[model samples]
Target chain A: MTERAVCVIGTGLIGGSLMRAAEKAGRAVWGTSASEDTAAEARADGFDVTTDTDDALRRAADADALVVLAVPLPVLPEVLRRVDAVAPEVRLTDAVSVKVAVADAVARYAPRARYVGGHPMAGTSESGWSAGLAELFVDAAWVVAADDGLDLDVWRDVAELAWACGARVVPAAADEHDLAVARVSHLPHLLAAVLAAVGAGGDDALPLALAAGSFADGTRVAGTRPELVLAMCEGNRDALLGAVDDALGRLGAMRGALASTGGLTATVFAGHAGRERWAASRDPKGVKVSLKGRAPLAALRAVGRRGAVVSGWKA
Target chain B: MTERAVCVIGTGLIGGSLMRAAEKAGRAVWGTSASEDTAAEARADGFDVTTDTDDALRRAADADALVVLAVPLPVLPEVLRRVDAVAPEVRLTDAVSVKVAVADAVARYAPRARYVGGHPMAGTSESGWSAGLAELFVDAAWVVAADDGLDLDVWRDVAELAWACGARVVPAAADEHDLAVARVSHLPHLLAAVLAAVGAGGDDALPLALAAGSFADGTRVAGTRPELVLAMCEGNRDALLGAVDDALGRLGAMRGALASTGGLTATVFAGHAGRERWAASRDPKGVKVSLKGRAPLAALRAVGRRGAVVSGWKA
Candidate 1:
């Protein structure tokens, strides 16, 4: 197989990291930034980058190259338009959060190009080229959203790109990806933002002083670039809103349970069991939450009767 | 001052850690557990523990000793009653989450003892004696709730105990402590629980596989011992409920703001600024969120006028 050339547009944290990962995979990697200063910084950091968007597209117009749109969601349509006009033959992909919108945009503007929508489930509460690390995608889940007319080979290329970055590739449809991420990622980010806002809006600085590991870890993502968070929430508004309602319903049930002694224990136990199972599967290096070996069906039935359901509990 | 002995009434994670910290601080430490198995485990782990509650209280009846009630809130009153009846001469303190309730209980039952309310902000998802570590409380905030009639020496003893464990002692009134922790700690814990429950309750195992660092960190405490989380939430139900309302209101506003292109950015930015300030104040080793060195008043006014009032913004 010939060496694959990878081009990432927008040299921010995700983009810069992808470039570095592609380079580490022995692929020829190039990057483009929205601003001259950012482009210069990326170049200074040993990335082959340019500030000229058109010029960047021209260089990546090769049919064998994978052109990754790494910009935020709101600007994706415009980026797609530019890419389709300048690099129509190149196979396309993205590292954007929301899939449906990107999938739709790619379908409308870049119909000829085989575009695979992807979201790498990895990032820090930091951004810009300076925050990028080559190991950012290690052991992370990279979701590849299937599009209707996309070729199988293009999907395989996206998966290969993710694997090259040490990521586990997860195949999902556009809507399925959105719904799943809304439950796991988007809703949690908004919830963290709300918690941060509440703590920050409290009287005096006592709330801040009392905020410990739980608060720090909970609100960590809320401290990310504000515009970035807003874009993500806005992009996946429908699914996120639905997830918020689902969570609020769960919380309401817990509140009702708290009204009676020992009622809340059922919910807490269910959450513990659920989280332990989920945690065990996701990251072994993370805090190991032990669960006594029990049949999944029995655990599921028990928790289901208790009015809570965990993912792995189901067959 | 003569070396003070410490007696911990429970050999779970918090109690065991307190015992270890006390021992490391050159204090003779003793502990009790409700279960013989747990007591035996504690003993195996080098803890001087007794399964008999009566004998544990009897051994801790020293006038110069500090008796720490490190148990669940549901059984806190019962433990206080036992201590009052068996060890009233001892200076009393507790490692409970809710301060107001514990203070009231101490007043009602252990009035003769020098009772001070202390809450150590430190833990891992794992619990029990085996999970306890001596360094658990290092650099953590230990809130010592102020009482009207508690002796100055008693307060000093609590502070000294926290310092001996390498904790920063934060003096706060009972109601104040409850309110602060409700906004910062309790509310976030429940929110994490809700997120965990939602992820667990999703249709497929895709959400679990796609769960990333944010979800992992956000739900870290959700995997803790179920009964403990229940006790903490139920113990501070009123305050936590109020905080939940506050957070929901903020989330509702953010949801509404998402309808407009730039509206949600205000809330996101406010959250970012608030969390940055809160994070900087809590943990020095934590990531420093730069705020452009502008006057805080201006920053506050800017965000407050934008309709989201972060604590740092509410002058």
Candidate 2:
């Protein structure tokens, strides 16, 4: 396979990690960022960084493959416009959290770009050039969401990149990606955030010391940039609404079951069992959590390269 | 500062750990059990074990000392009955979960035992004769629940032991202890158990490999003996019920907040902050989580033992 000039927008945790991963995989990597300072920092970090979307677009215009809109959800449509205007001939993909809105937005703003909506079902609380690590995507999941009209090789190229980045490639439609994320990532973020708010809210002296590992790990994602989570929740509002309701509805029902002291006790145990499964996805060596047992090839996920195995204390 | 004979009924985790702590403290550690086999094991484990409640009664009859009912909550009333019948003149304590039930039952069955319901907020998923660790109560929280009529010295003695074991002593009324455990311990257990059951009962192919550190650590205490938790929930039904309701209520509010996605508003950030403080409680250092910052002391309350810090890279 010929090497491709891959353009990564944002240059933060996800995008920087992808640039680092692609560069590590020997792909010619380039970047753009929302801020000139961030773009300069990426340049300092040794990537060919630019805040000029047109320059980034020009760099990948002749390529058989490229990544556009490798940024936050709110700015995706603008990123798509810039890329499509300059790199309309290139095959395209995105790494957005909620794909439906972005996909719809892309269709409106960049209908000519051979765009395939994609979401790497992974990330960390860390951000920026400093957070980049090459293996961030190892064993993690990347959901590929695209309709049948795109060229077959384009889909293959994106899936291949995900695999090369050590991510498990799962195919889904745009809406399905939104739904799944709302259930898995978005809802959990909200849950953690609210738990933090109410559990420790407004108290002059927060006696949070009683909380153990579970609460911390369970709510870890909440401490990240609140704006990011808000975008995700809002971008995928309908699905997120359904997912939140599902979680609350299920928990409510479980409480009722426990109230009876008997009956189908399966639901109660099921929730814990799911948590047990999610917890086991750690990088055996570094502490990064890998989806489907493969670690991401992204640099950002490698910050906690020496991961915590809480149960590592074997008797 | 006088050594005295203390009878520990139910030679299990709480009883055995207490027996060991007491013996190490140079006190007469006498223990009993409903089963002869366990009593023998307790004796073999270096305790002065006895099945004779009458002998224990004789031993404590003339002293201002400690006697612990380290039995299950459901069985506490009957055990307290036996203690009343044979050792009615002794000062007593217990390591049981449900305070209200045990207190009410003790009032009915062993009014003369000077009983103060206690729960050493310490445990492992493993139970039985071998699960007791010397440092089990060390740097752990010991909830001392008492009514108004109790002797302050008796409370002091129990607090001293917990402190000797490197524990933080927290005073709580019966109802207070019940509610607190429901919030911090019992509710988490039930929730974890329920989640575990769900996972175990589901698609057998759910890779336990994906069950990384977070899920495992979070659910560590979930897989504990079901009967123990059942007894707790059943015994402290009122408080546990209220906690479960509270938990579900929190989950519900969180759900609504997440689904609405009115941006990364202060409401969401509040949750994140609350969780951050709560997650700081886990101190995975030498011998104590509750002993986070405390130096080796004999009778101090561990202030740093409760908060669990979450997210970010480090704890």
Candidate 3:
């Protein structure tokens, strides 16, 4: 099978990295950035990058390339409008942090696009084209939305792209993806922000000075660009609100236990168990699903539900 | 002056590391552990480790060595009683995580001892002597309680001990240190526990599979031994309660904004600013304090309040 050419929109860290990874995987790849300076930088680096989103889409449409939307959440609508105008029937996916939001926006603005939402669970705190790396997605879990009635053809295209970039595919419904990420990703980001603020908000700088590894690790994500964090966090507000509520409930229970009984056995043990569960889930045994098999979507979702990842497709 | 001999009363990670660091710094160091197995292991490693706390304290008294209480919070009272019986007047200090609790315990159990509370702000999740590294305290902050009326002679001994362990001195009042660590250390531990439990508490394991660096870092401290976490967090209940309340307030406000205005602008910006402040405070300009000067305690406290670390003492 001929590899699908990848046309990545918004040549920032994620998009630029995807373009590089796809190219390195022997797929023809090009990208466009909203920032002319970013496009110029990528072009100067010998990548086929441009500021003309419409032109890139036109070429992608002509070549039947896989189009990956890599813009931040706040600009999804504007980018979707352009996708709608230039390549409404293109094979489309996204690298946006939030899936349901992007799915809804695509339904509203680019209804004809064969869109399969995706989020590669990978990145550094750093951003911009300069921080792009071909290996960013290596060994990362890349979520491809397996919502009902999705285009299997486009889904395969996106999955192939992820696999080509050395990521394992974890098929999940768009809503499920949103909720899961809210717990693991979005909530952590918010908590980090709060932790950072609390650590620095003290009258004396003693807290900041005395902060060691826990403080550094717990608040690491707070160093991410505020605008980017705001976009992703606020975009998944509903799911994140639920996650935040769950965390607050736990915190309240913890405080009450500490105040009354002077014991954190429940909280600490529960957390340790949780961390153990996570550790056990790492480097999970690889599972394969034939895309042409009966109930491929069901199989994929079942694998994901069991915390298993599709390392690759089976013949 | 000749280096004071060191007697560490608990040969676990921090205590064992301190013994190694002190010995490496040319101080005569010996240690005791509540666990005979650990003591035996240290003894096998060619260190002077014993399971007899009273014997260790008696020897420390004979040599007029620094008595470093390296036991957990729960066992501190018992250890202090031994100190009262065997070495009540020895130059004393502690390596407890919570200073106020240790100080209060020392006052209650060994009131005649010239005690100076201290905490080396460094550790790993692993415990026992096997995990101890001689370089563990190198470049780490060793906080010595600078509360008023402290024995200047013992204070110098503790400060010099910290320096001998290749750590910089951070002078803070017991109450101030408790509050500061409540915000920076204990609170992060609690938050990490909550985060780990929440991430693992999901009905499906998809969240765990999708977990990335943010989730990993946020919950890293949750992997620490539960007993240790419980002892430190519960030992400093009053201050930790305040920190937990502060975190809950920030989380509540963040949720409210996300739900109402769909904007995390304020929270994100505040967190970003906090992280930036922390980054700015790293590798701060070295400052010196004269241990023999007038109002040295006041000078140390002033330096600590300004987030300046005492890298060394002036003659």
Arrange candidates by TM-score, descending. 3, 1, 2
DockQ ranking from best candidate downward:
3, 1, 2
**What TM-score between 0 and 1 does chain B of candidate 3 receive?**
0.96
lDDT of 2 by residue, A175-260 (tens): 64565565555655665565455445422221243343334444566677777766677777787777666656666776776678
Q: If scored against the real structure, what TM-score would every candidate get?
A: 0.83, 0.79, 0.97
The sequence of per-residue lDDT tens digits that candidate 1 reaches over residues B1-315 is 446788889888899999998899899888889999998988887879987776777776744677888888778778888877887767889998899998888888778887878899888878889889999998887877654555656666777788789887666777777888888888877887788888888766777878887788888888777777777877897777788778767766766666544256767777788788776674432211112344432332232122222211111
lDDT of each: 0.75, 0.62, 0.91
TM-score of chain A of each: 0.84, 0.81, 0.97
Q: Measured by TM-score, how close is model 1 to the native structure?
A: 0.83
Per residue, candidate 3 scores C-alpha lDDT tens digits across A141-184 of 99999987788899889989999999999999888999999999
Which of candidates 2 and 3 reaches a greater DockQ? 3
Error of 3 at A176 (Å): 0.6
Best by DockQ: 3
Candidate 1's error at B211, in angstroms? 1.7
Query: Positional deviation of B140 in candidate 3, in angstroms?
Result: 0.9
TM value for model 2: 0.79
> DockQ of candidate 3?
0.88
CA lDDT for candidate 3: 0.91
Which residue ranges in model 2 land beyond 4 Å of their true spot? A1-5, A201-210, A213-218, A255-267, A272-315, B1-6, B20-30, B33-65, B190-225, B247-267, B277-315
For model 2 the local lDDT of residue B37 reads 85
